[model samples]
Target: MKILTLHGINLNMFGKRDPKQYGTATLAQIDDQLRALGQELGAEVECFQTNFEGEMAERIHRAHTDGTDAVIINAGAWTHYSYGLRDALAILKCPIIEVHMSNIHAREAFRHVSVIAEIARGQIAGFGVDSYLLGLRAAVSAVQQG
Candidate 1:
């Protein structure tokens, strides 16, 4: 299976952004781990990180044409808003798992609402970097089941 992982907004600053919430792993380190896990699972995982909303949306739109089987997206602050991202996700024909490093529901009042969650097959949060791994695993399983 081919999976596309999208990391959004301030996420590029990961480890340095908030060690207490996002953990100590840098974005690159996390991507490497995900890539290795994907290989172990016999799946092709492609990752993209952008601090721009439009770029992230374009990437999602491109996934349909890139032969991606599923997508795992952590839209950072965009999760609470950005209907455009939500719409882009809604257009994808594959399964999408929304992920977050911190549990939004337990964070700021604003973080509790995720626009993407309305269109995603599921949402994974509060597990730190494991959220992405779990999302990837779920994406692979969803594709296999279909």
Candidate 2:
């Protein structure tokens, strides 16, 4: 199966941005781990990282035409407010699993709400980078079950 992985906003600065909250792994390192996990599961993983909201939306739009079977996205701050991202996700026929590195609910009040969760197949958060792997696994399982 083909899975598209998207990293949004400040996530590109993962390791360097906040070592306490986001851990010490760079975005590239996280992608490497996810890619390894995907290979182990016999799935092809294509990843994209963008700080721009419109670019992320464009990637989501492209996923539909790229034969993507599922999508795993960590929309950073966009999780709380980007209706455009939610709308892009809504348009996809495939399953989408929203992921967060930190537990948003435990953070600032503003981080507690996720606009994208309303339209996602499921959400995985608060497990650090494991959230991405877990989301991917869940997405793969959902695709297989369907």
Candidate 3:
């Protein structure tokens, strides 16, 4: 299966960002973990990170054309707002799994809402890098059972 993993907005700064919340894992580390887990799950994982909203939306559009079987997204701050990304994800026929290293619901009020939730098949959060790993597994499972 083909899985697209999206890291958005300021997520590129994961390691340098709030270590208290995001932990010390760099974005590259997170991607490496996803790829490794994907391999074990028999899925090909492609990860994309972008600070630009339009670029992310465009990437999601491409995923639609690429016939991606599933998408695992940790859309950073975009998770709370980015309707553009949500709309792009809506175009896909495959499963969408939203993930967060932190527990968004337990964070600030502004961070509590996920615009992507309604359209997503499921959500996994609060497990640091494990969230991405779990998301990948969820994506693979969703594709298999779908």
Candidate 4:
């Protein structure tokens, strides 16, 4: 199975941004962990990170034609208001799993809302990097079940 992982905006600063919520794992390290877990899950994981909203939307467009079986996304602040990204994801026929390192609901009031949640197959959060892994597993399971 082919799985695409999308990391958005400011997430490139995973390690240096804020150790309190994001932890010390660099984006590269997080990608490595996802790839390793994907291998064990018998899925090929392709990761993409972009600080630009247009680029992310474009990538989602590509995933539509790329035959991606599932998608795991952590869209950072964009998760709250990026209708463009959500619309792009809506074009996909595969399962979409949203993830967050921190519990967005437990954070600021603005962070409590997710525009992507309505379109996503499900969501995982509050367990740091484990959220990504769980999201991946959820995506794979959803694909298999279908």
Candidate 5:
């Protein structure tokens, strides 16, 4: 199965943004780990990240054309209010999983709402990098079961 893992907005600055929250892992490091985990789970993983909302939406559209079997997205701040991204994800036929390194619910009130949650098959948060890993495992399992 092919799983597209998307990181959004300021996520590229993960390691430098806030050590208290995102930990010290760079975006590359996180993707590399997810790829390794994906291999063990028998799924091919492709990762993408962009600060631009339009570009993120475009990538989601491309994933549809590319025949991606599942998607795991951590849309950063966009997770709270980007209806456009949510719409793009809604277009996908495969399972969509939303993940976050920090617990949005435990943060500021603005961070508590997720526009993507309505369309996603599941949401995993507050477990740091493990959230992404779990999201990947969930996507793979969903595809295999389907």
Candidate 6:
């Protein structure tokens, strides 16, 4: 299976930003772990990160035609208010799992809502980098079941 992992906004600042909320793992470290885990699950994983919403949307468009089997996304702050990204993801027929390193619900009021949740197959959050891993596993499992 082929899976695409999308990391948006300030995610590249993972290890440097708020260690109390996000773990010390750098973005590259997180991606490497996801890729390694993907291999263990017999899936091909491709990861993309960007601070630009438009670029992220364009990447999602490319995935639509790129034969991507599923998607695991941790759209950072975009999760709270990026309809463009949500609509871009809506175009995909494959399953999508929205993930969050920190638990949005337990954070400030502004972080509690997600623009992508309604379109996603499901969501995983609050488990640090493990949330991404679980999202990948869920997406792959969903794809296999279908």
> What are the runs in model 4 whose C-alpha is more than 4 Å off?
none
TM-score of every prediction relative to native = 0.98, 0.98, 0.98, 0.98, 0.98, 0.99
User: Which ranges of candidate 5 are over 4 A from the true structure?
Assistant: none
> Is candidate 2 or 4 superior in lDDT?
4
Q: After superposition, which runs of candidate 1 have C-alpha atoms over 4 Å from their true positions? A: none
Q: Give the clash total for candidate 3.
A: 0
Let me know the TM-score candidate 4 reaches against the reference structure: 0.98
Q: In terms of lDDT, which candidate is stronger, 3 or 6?
A: 6
The stretch of ten residues in a row with the least summed lDDT in candidate 1 is 57-66
In candidate 5, how many Å is residue 41 off? Answer: 0.8
Clashing pairs in 1: none
Order of quality (lDDT): 6, 5, 4, 3, 1, 2
* Weakest ten-residue segment in model 6 by summed lDDT: 77-86
Off by over 4 Å in 6: none
Give stretches of model 3 more than 4 Å off: none
User: How much lDDT does each candidate structure score?
Assistant: 0.92, 0.92, 0.93, 0.95, 0.95, 0.96
Candidate 4: pairs in clash? none
User: Per-residue lDDT of 1-146 in model 5, one digit per residue for the tens?
Assistant: 89999999999998999889889989999999999999999999999999999999999999988989999999999999999999999999999999999999999999999999999999999999999999999999999889
Provide backbone clash counts, one per model. 0, 0, 0, 0, 0, 0
lDDT of 1: 0.92
lDDT of 2 at 75: 93
Displacement of the residue 133 alpha carbon in candidate 5, Å: 0.5
RMSD for each model, in Å, please?
Answer: 0.6, 0.7, 0.7, 0.6, 0.6, 0.5
- Candidate 2 structure quality by residue, lDDT tens digits, 1-146: 99899999989899998787899999999999989999998889888999889989999999989899999999999999999999999999999999999999899999999999988999998999899999989989988987
TM-score of 1: 0.98
Please give the TM-score that candidate 6 achieves against the real structure.
Answer: 0.99
